[model samples]
Target: MQAKIKKVELRNLAFEDYKQLKNSMVESYPEMADSYWRANDIERLLGIFPEGQLVILVDGKVVGSALSLIVAEKLVDKKHNYSQIIGDYSFSTHNPQGEILYGIDVFIHPNYRGLRLGRRLYDARKELCEQLNLKAIVFAGRIPSYGQYSNKLTPTKYIEKVKSKQLHDPVLSFQLSNDFHVLRIMKNYLAGDEDSKEFAVLLEWNNIYFDESPRLINTEKNVIRLGLIQWQMRSLGNLEALFEQSEFFIDVVSGYTCDFAVFPELFIAPLMADYNHLTEAEAIRELAKHSEPIRKRFQELAISYNINIISGSMPYLENGNLYNVGFLCKRDGTSEMYTKIHVTPNEVQHWGMKGGSEIKTFDTDCGKIGIMICYDVEFPEVSRIMADEGMNILFVPFLTDTQNAYIRVKHCAQARAIENECYVAIAGCVGNLPKVNNMDIQYAQTAVFTPSDFAFPSNGIKAEATPNTEMTLIVDVDLRLLKELHEHGSVRILKDRRTDLYQIKKIEN
Candidate 1:
């Protein structure tokens, strides 16, 4: 036997669903009937700002509703009763230019309470708040269970207890869990509230992603999605095999809607096995022969897959000199290269390569970014210079032969993220290629690092792949968080730098 279908949806409030909405609110708040909105009031709300009125449906039944209005941030600064603030239920206080979403009411039917419909309504409201790019959501939240402790504790004391988890008030507890902090305690905020004793808590949830600048463009995104490919080292007979493998990873990451696909440095170096009879320097030089064609092919892959490709560091023969290089193959079919600025001692001794003298950030459709190859990230100055260029993300494509070497790259990359106040994503080659000279062993643990702060991961690592594993790590980092961190983080390392004491500047090559 087949089970019944249950479809749930959230949508703007409608006058036609007033009956269902009324039923849900009436049952959700039996203690606040006198405060319920009337038909003409709902009409006025719809007439003023229909978008802010939202409802959630469970199988075509209205199970929850959230009503809100935009008001100037200053309008909510002082104390005011619910009726006075909402203009006596007429919602005349709504200001289209306002940056705050003042929540008038939110309720879910008792029948659907077990389904956590309140959370659904709140999440929808939060999404709408972000879509409108509002500053925050403010509301007078009811503490229905306050009457139980009214005799023993003051409202402020009770709120403190609830916030500390020493006490539990269903409404306030849910709001606290949803990241809404109690701003203040209000006396006589509502009338005829026996449970709340005519008192309420002013709660607020700020939109950390909020922007003050007027949005002239609608499609711009502050959150960037990245795909890190932890490649395995394997010898191949020809270039076609390597291209096939590269395309496979690109396909997988793109399937998940990644904005950019990144491969580890020298991930294609296994092709060097073809010149095994030659010296290490000679074989790598031969590898440089494929750089131009590989870049063009990767460009095609980027456009075809609809993802930007960071074609990991390669050997480039330019002006009769070898330089390690990487390409940023944008989805628009445009591409640019950032040559590795610091060659490791092994790279210099084994391949007779010189580091590229040029240092700059690359501009993409997403935002400004910098690409550092292996040892370049080990030097704080390289990233510090790029950070000055307003780079949002720093990508490090590295290859390390052992865990110790990988740790140096990893730890330094993390430091760069914190000090620069930018996201740092690093990918590397894993596994081994014993048959390929100078590519005999590999060690890697791919990870995306975020600025160390309250808004980001506690340990600073967002997502990481299993050690020495051939896998893809896809993660999203918000550019807005970096902005907030720079301007208002607990420890503003980027802003607190003692510039007068020391400075980092790029010298012309």
Candidate 2:
């Protein structure tokens, strides 16, 4: 039969033809006979749907038919919209935002059964959806009434077979052949056949493109060793006590055969002593005099140890302005500095500091890395920007004085790892430093955290020094594993991000 396919006009169809279609459905499956026979109710539902969804022919007769509906789902603060070809009526929610659909039903006259009209109708609807740029698409298949008459299997068994790997089943091969994967089994959806269960599969096909070309090669060694030096001062009274502990921390760090060593924020707190007692100008001079010796010692240690050191954030007076910056020192004594981008409220209001507006991802012999000072890791943008720039390791330097704050710091590091799909190594202080003028106050507790499938994992701790004790925490980092994780979806939050829907601005340095 060479009948051409066209849109269905349910309202304009002759009353006799409408009755005949309904009777055919009921006759094909007695279970839905009563519900299918209700022409007035079906018309009422059809009236609410979008026009032109139900497809049929006009050979001066009501013959072939098909239908479709647009569908969507909201995800991760974004809307992922798609379309589906549902037979007969166009289904949709009034708001088009919430989850709901109005299914349009289409029925072809028995005389056109042998023609290829259904294929043409399905293809046309699919083309219309593609033109709309829908992200997700699907189609619902109801077990046709003819399945009830087939003796090869029971209705329940037949539906199960069609829904699960029975794509070759002549009744439902069209959907499977069109690339729909079974999603789930939904029951009791058919009218008048409320007792019967209907199997439904939610198949998904993605249209997003990944075009970035990144080249990464393997080195002879798969892992890199890192050492963390968490330093703190308990009070401003005992300056000698602070230096003594620093010496011990340095000693332990020097002893380690590490590729890199990191010190926590405000690594040396001597300057705060005079700042609290004198004017800003006088305090700056005093702090400068005292911090010089400490920094000279650190540079010497980095050179002697023959290891790269990220001399975490410190109160530095460079060209008159005091900045909280991290110094990246090479084994040859050459160094680069990075100012913290995101500062806490206290640092701004009380300390008279401004946050830096730069993202610095450094290239090193081991691999590309980024450094986040304390609070910066809490913001997704910090690590996200680094990831987008191809930085695979995030070194975090934090001075967490309290236990609760330490926990928050740990969680933030883990979140960064997941968001960036990379590795994170966070070093935080663990011990106390006596006040500059006093001899007895010291605080301690330091730890290191790494990236994990769930969050950042605390795989190793070099040492959590006693309240006044000093120590170095050294651990081997698997750089190869980090790269593998980013490639595989092991810690892949970034993989699920919908970049086309959102925009990210670069933080200017």
CA RMSD of each candidate after superposition: 9.8, 18.3
What's the lDDT for all of these models?
0.90, 0.56
lDDT of 2 by residue, 1-509 (tens): 33654543333233345655565455444545354535553454345433324445555454544433444443211322222222222333322332222223444544566565566555554444444444444434555542444455665566566657553454355556554555443343343432233433334432222112324653334477777775544553555666566556656666766778877777566546656566443554455455555566667777877777787776656666555777777777877778887888766654555677678688765678899898888888767888888787788888765667767777777767656766677766545544433212323354544555532354523234444345566777666555545544343666667788995769454
Best by TM-score: 1
Give the Cα error of residue 228 in candidate 1, in Å. 0.6
Local accuracy of candidate 1 as per-residue lDDT tens digits, 357-400: 99899988788999999899999998999999899899999999
Name every residue pair that clashes in candidate 1: none
Q: How do the predictions measure up, each by TM-score? A: 0.62, 0.51
Error of 2 at 254 (Å): 3.8
- The CA lDDT at 455 in model 2 is 25
List runs of model 2 lying over 4 Å from the truth.
Answer: 1-221, 232-248, 274-276, 279-297, 318-320, 431-445, 454-469, 507-509
- Please provide the root mean square deviation of candidate 2 (C-alpha atoms, Å): 18.3
